[model samples]
Target chain A: MLDLSRVQKELVDCNRDKSSGVSIDLVGDQLSHLAGTISGPIGTPYEGGVFRIDIRLPDGYPFEPPKMQFVTKVWHPNISSQNGAICLDILKDQWSPALTLKTALLSLQALLSAPEPDDPQDAVVAQQYLRDYPTFLGTARYWTEAFARRVSIGTEEKVQKLVEMGFPEALVRTTLENAGGDENMALEKLCSG
Target chain B: MGWIKVITKESLLVAQREDLRNIMDLLEVSEKHARTLLIHHRWDADSLLAVFLEKERDRLFSEAGVTIAEPNVLAPLQSSQVTCNICNEDVSADAVTTMDCGHGFCNNCWTEHFIVKINDGQSRRIRCMFYKCNTICDEAIVRNLVSAKHPDLAERFDRFLLESYIEDNHKVKWCPSVPHCGNAIRVDGDGYCEVECSCGLQFCFSCSAEAHSPCSCLMWELWVKKCRDESETVNWITVNTKPCPRCLKPVEKNGGCNHVRCICGQDFCWLCGCAADQHHARSSCGSYKEEREKKTGQAKRDLFRYMHYYNRYKAHTDSLKLESKLKKAIQDMETISDSKEFSIKDFSWLTNGLYRLFRSRRVLSYSYPFAFYMFGDDLFKDEMTPEERELKQHLFEDLQQQLGANVEKLSHFIEESFDEFLQVDRIMGIRMQVINLSALIDNLCKKMYEFIENDLLGRLERVTHNIAPYESKGVERASELSDSWDSDDSLSMKTCNVDSYLQWDSSANGAGSSESGSPTDDSFDQSSSLDESGCSSRKRAKKEALDDPPFNLNLPAEGFDKN
Candidate 1:
């Protein structure tokens, strides 16, 4: 069984510090599924971007490392451009029970700043990072601008769009709130329920 | 003779005790620390000793996570409470367990960590839960904590640690028996030899395939693959069939003209295998191209050369299979001679000659594949000039033919129905011939191996191939390890689960009795061919022993015929 009390404590502890530049929120009511967001480190190609990561805690949570992968597309050598598989050692065999979701997100932010091209998840990006440095930087910057920028649309605008799709305004508001501000997850909830 | 020992599940700890004791005594460490070092070095004591001599004691101990120094003492606690970073909860001092690394965690969290790592198959080195702390958590702690919660998983962890002697070592390999005999064979000397497992399966120690010597392991692997591929039949199919352009499946023309239609509804010209339309079918597609035939000249010769050796190899193997039936008939003749009024009650000459025939015949059959690679352009083309290759081929073939002819003579004499002979002198003459023939065949087999090992393979450059040296007897039977290691009280208790051992003990006993006992004394004397059918069953029957009272596990290997 997952240590639900520890996970609850972790959530309370991680969210208490706003300056950590990493925050995790439950994707659903279940403690097993979560979403984490980390600000890209400043003075890198990924600066000014907020990268969303999909986190799933296995039953052996805290004992086994939580499974984290990039949901926001970013062009980096160590993070897969195609599927967002990470090649970070801490996420794998080096994972210790002491590590939390917040630490993992911070590690990802560090991976963005210092991409290890030699041990890469994306071979093409790694090759470009090695052979053609300027192009790799350009591609990474363009991808951050294209994908990792937070959707700036207002909640009113989201309500208007769903209202335009023939759902009642009050129901859309509750569903959007229930989906934790994720428009797609809210839309899925709206359609299914 | 190779010093090979058979290690069953029951004898696994006894097999591992030797090395573990050496490391424990040499390093003067506890069993857990010794195990950590041995597992780190993959149970190689000599290499561990080398590292011990070269490196400082602190470095060696720290590298393998064996903590000998006293852990740093902390300041006296204001209260009997401390916080475990993993759970981030305040706990009483009694609830916390500190490792040698001086890092402490709540007992609950530590137990959970051990369970997770053990379940993940990382039991061999479950390091401290603290991040970046490479100190391996003591095995006693792991066992004590894990057994408190999950006894079964702790047993699994124990088995994995015990099995590391075989699982992690290159010198030992589990016998590849179907439905698994639960046995491992440990070869002490060079691994480039063949061994007959106590379960009666004979295999090359290097590749673990059926014993195929004279042919190098590489050559034997290729020959088995080629034979399985049925490359000759495949070549014939390639010559006869054309792939359909639509489906790309090979389509043979059973009886048709130059145009052929596949089941997939694609029509193609048989001459060029190009898709055929109505207009192309009416016209002559093309003339039979002479250049295509010229291009396949080298491949054609290679195919013929392969067929030449393959045919002879198949012929000898086929004779070997048929001669096995002759073994039964000879045994019947022995029975008949026993009841008759003949003075000769001993049939040792007939059985000995038969055993010699089987051994030499195998040497002859495998020699074909050996020659196929030795002289062929594929393996050793540049190793010898054409003239040198020709001269060497003749020299090798001369020895092969001499061995082959003598083996046939021995087979012929063994098959004689001398029991029907009323004249006592007639039986005596045949006995003499059989005895002489057996020794001659044994000598010829020895010479063939010597010539191949010393003259042919020894002289080759740019490639090294070592065949298993010939034994005057057949493949060496791996001996059962004695029960002396039972004195290692530290392991014998936890090495195996008593219930599971009993389950196996009963199952093995059942396999033994149903197959009939005394398989060695009767069938083995007449023919070695009975080994496959009789030997394993009899070995299991003897293994039905070890009825030592309650987990002493003092099972000694039995039923070895010294002769």
Candidate 2:
């Protein structure tokens, strides 16, 4: 059995260090279960949306990358699975020695800008990505409003979401920043109790 | 006596003719006497040898005297061929002709003349007595001459020459002036005077007078005794013993020896040498042999007490003289502080001897002849704090500027002393003066540093400042100003020399010395003797230096002044 608590700490820092970020958490103190959140990168069609994600650390973490998945169903070719299983090179076999939580979050923000469909973990999202990119972005936004927007920021939110999770009260008051009005989705993190 | 003979041809001819003109021309001896000699030789100048035989024959007659033996066969009959010039007798073939003069004289006569001339202390310049030839005679003439022929005349001539030298110039001892004073003194050391006649005539050594003896042994003995008796005499008691009469070894009369003999075995006649001998004189005479049985018993009693006090007094006086000599030496010796060369130990010995001599000679028995009065008000000290010192700066400056500057006041001080001096107070004579001077010098030395360091320095600085800066402008002008000031100062510095001047000293001399020595005797150092030699007379101007100074305070903090 793997203790997933280490992934919760990294997921919390991912949100604090980068605004368009992703996070992970252990599920109910159970050994192999986790929870997380993901955000849309700003200035593109996905700017007004929220995304949910989940993660789990292996027993050998820091040597092993955390397992990440999309909790909110999305049509994004980069993010895969209804449970937020994401495939990124850093998380897989291609990870470098010097990568950290903040670098991982920044990498995620870059992936939103230029997603790699050919190596998509979701074949349906990848086909739609080749056929009509605008609709895939539209569906991805809808999924963020339908799933991640309904929740409050997690108590285990990353540093930025902890701030959104009421660590700093000012970030939570702006409805315009939360386009789907999903406080729970913005605040939810692997660090949630 | 024989002599060398010398003659001029003219003089010889005149003599042969019997002109006898030598005596007539003798006013100044204008003509020098020439010398001729006749010598006996191996050469046979037959005629000269014949004259020599004639002279010898004449000598035999004169020496033996003209005795006509009744059987006088050997006596030659009178023949007027030639007379021997020296013996006034007949000259036969034996008569010798004096070589240079060719005059014939008896051989014995010529020989004796030469010997007489040589014996005279003057070995040079003797000539023969030949009538015509006044020549220095040779050895042959000397051997031929005989003096016995005219012994009476020779004795007369010697006596005349001696009398003449004495009449001209030379010293001869003179009889003491007292008719038959039976003493003679040579006018050798310091001209002859009858005053110090050693034979006890009381005549002067320089001139014949009772008063001429400036000091006498008797007076010296009395003075010495009195000096030894002085209060300070106790400090120098050991020296009071009279020295040996011969060796001057101080003799202490120890044990039963009636006569004290020095280490050299010379008996010291103490009374004769010093007053101490009077003890022996009176003690020895105390037991005069009692004449009768009546006073015999009383005489013994008288003998016991006869000279007891006198003997004691005499002994005391002797010791006192030694003590005083020691004191005088200390007083008269060149000041140890005055000279750098003297060591304290050397000074002590000298002083001790002088102390002995002083008491032995009693020159200081009188009031000390000198005293000092210092007028410097600047004697207050800087080293000693205010509570310890008394002289203040203001008062000192006032005293110097006001009182000291006035010569009249100083004259009054001197006059006051003078008036007291005129009153012959014998008991407190120069003794008082010496005591006063000792205190004065000590006090002055003590006060001088205080004066110099505390007050004099500041005052002197002011005085130096008062001197105008003259090292500027032309060197000649600066020097000329100095010269003018120096001359003016010289005029300011003078004290009057004349007897009639009723003036006060009108100047402040930095360290003025009186030129006349004793204050009593024309200002010669009126100080009492510092010597065994008669009062070590010094002029008043001769100030003794206390120690060498230009004193660097680093040298044990003592101020020294150089002589």
Candidate 3:
């Protein structure tokens, strides 16, 4: 079984530190499924982007590493472009029970900054990264702009959008703030509520 | 000679125990640590020793995930309680167990880690649960913790550890039997040799295919694939058919002139395989292209050359299949001769010749494929000049032809109705001929092997092809691995079922050309023995003749004189 108490503890502890720029929240009521978000490291092609990761804890959680895949698309040599499959060692054979969802998300942020072109999940991206550095940099920055950047829509607009979808305005504002300014999350919370 | 031993499931422990014991004794380590070291080295003791001697003790131990904990570093926690980072729980210190690496985790977390790794088929090297700590967890702990919750998985873990000897070792290979026999064969030395398993499946140890010696594993592999593929049939099609210009389908001319109509209703000239209406007469179609003819000529010659060898190989193979039925006929003859009042009541020569025929027929068939690759431009084109290839081919083929002719003669004599012979001298004459021929075939087969190994393949410059040396007896049947048999004893031992006479025959005639005289001379000596002992001699000779054994020959040792 998933260590529900531990996962719950991890969520609370991770959310307590907002400065870490990595947070985990329950995707549904089940502790096994969660959504993690990591702000890209500064001075990298992926800077200013908040990448969402989908985390699913196997039954052997704490013993087995949680399966993490990209939810917000980002261009890098080690993350698949066609499917948001991240090829990180910590997610595979190198995984240890000592790691948690927060550390895994931080590792993803590190992977974004330092893309391993030699051991790549995306061959085309890796080839460009090795052969033409400028093109790889431009493509990664463009992908961050196109896909990973957080919506800059004002809190009032998100609240208005939710309220227009038959939700109370006060609840919409709080939900948008809780979702970290993610309009889609605010809409989902409003509809579910 | 190299020996083979069958490692059945029951004897697998014994098979691996020797290697484990060696590493354990030499390294002064426990069995678990020894196993970890062996497994890390893929059960290669020599290479492990080389590494042990060359590298630092700490490095060797650390590389294999064997953590020899520093005593000072393994101090127990002062407080009775601690927080286990894995589950983020505060548990009593008694609930936690510290590994040799000095990293402690709660029992629950450790068990979960072992279960996950075991299920993932990584039970062979279940490292510590602590991150970045490469220490391998103790097997005893794993077994203890796992068996508490899941007993079957613990058993699977033990089996995986035991089977790693065969799975990881280079010298041992699983018998490639269909619906797998659950047995592996371990050769003592020379992986190039062929061996017959206890289950009676003979295979080339190097390639694990059916035993095809006199031909290297590479040649036999290519020969088998070539026979299986439709390349020859395609060659036949190319030789006999022309494609229609419209549909690009190969069209065989049933019976027609050069200008024929295809079934697709397209009229084409067969010479150049081009469309021919009314006005398209013999413009360029009649003129032959030099390049096309050369290519086609080469293909035609290759097809014919392959046919020459393939036909002989197939013929001998088919004869072997048919002659296997002769065993029952020979048995009936044995029964008839037993009831007869003839002077030549001992028909041991008949069965001996029959065994020789079977052995030689196999050698004869596989030699064709050997010659095909040896002389042909496919494998060894650069290995030899054309003149040298022809000379070596003649030398090898002469031996092959002599062996083939003698095998046919032996087969013919064994097939004859000797049981119906009324004349005593006629039966005796046939007996002498059969005995002589058997020995001659055996010697010729030995010579052919020597020639292939020493003269032909040994002289190659760049590449080496090792064929299994010929056994005068037959393909050596692998002995069962028993507790009583040690490595030293197994080295000198022949097949467990072989009689002392065979031991004498094989060992006594090792490499003395003077002692290994003509086959007729050996037969004459055996006939003299037959003349002296009479009834007892027949039983002794029959025992020597029969392939399967455990018959007591009860004669004086000096009286036994045979090849």
User: Which structure among the candidates has the greatest DockQ?
Assistant: 3
- Estimated TM-score for each candidate: 0.78, 0.19, 0.78
Give residue B203's error in model 1 in angstroms. Answer: 0.7
Candidate 1 C-alpha lDDT tens digits along B235-277: 6766788768777677999885777899999988887777898
- The model with the greatest lDDT is 3
lDDT of 1 by residue, A38-154 (tens): 888899989988887878999988999889888777899998998788889888989998888878888998999899998989999999999999999899999888777666788
Show the lowest summed lDDT stretch of 10 residues, model 2 chain B. Answer: B471-480
lDDT digits (tens) for residues A6-117 of candidate 3: 9888999999999999999776577887888898899999998888877899888878889988877778999999878999999998999998888888888889888899
List, residue by residue over A46-81, the lDDT tens digit for candidate 2. Answer: 564555444555544433455665555666677764
The model with the greater DockQ, 1 or 2, is 1
TM-score for predicted model 2 compared with the true structure: 0.19
- Candidate 2 structure quality by residue, lDDT tens digits, B1-563: 00111112222232112111221132111111111111111111233236546676434222222122234443443454565533335666555443433444555445444444444432223443432233333322333242345545444434322222122112212234465433333232233222222233433333233321112323323434544564253323334565565554456776564456677777645444422342565654445464433323443343323233223334544644444444433434444334444222123223222222222122111111100001112222233355433454344334323322222232222223323234434313323333333223333333433443345333432232111111101011000011122453222122123221111111113122355443333222222222222332222212221111111112111222210
| Structure candidate 3, residue pairs in collision | none
Steric clashes per prediction: 0, 128, 0
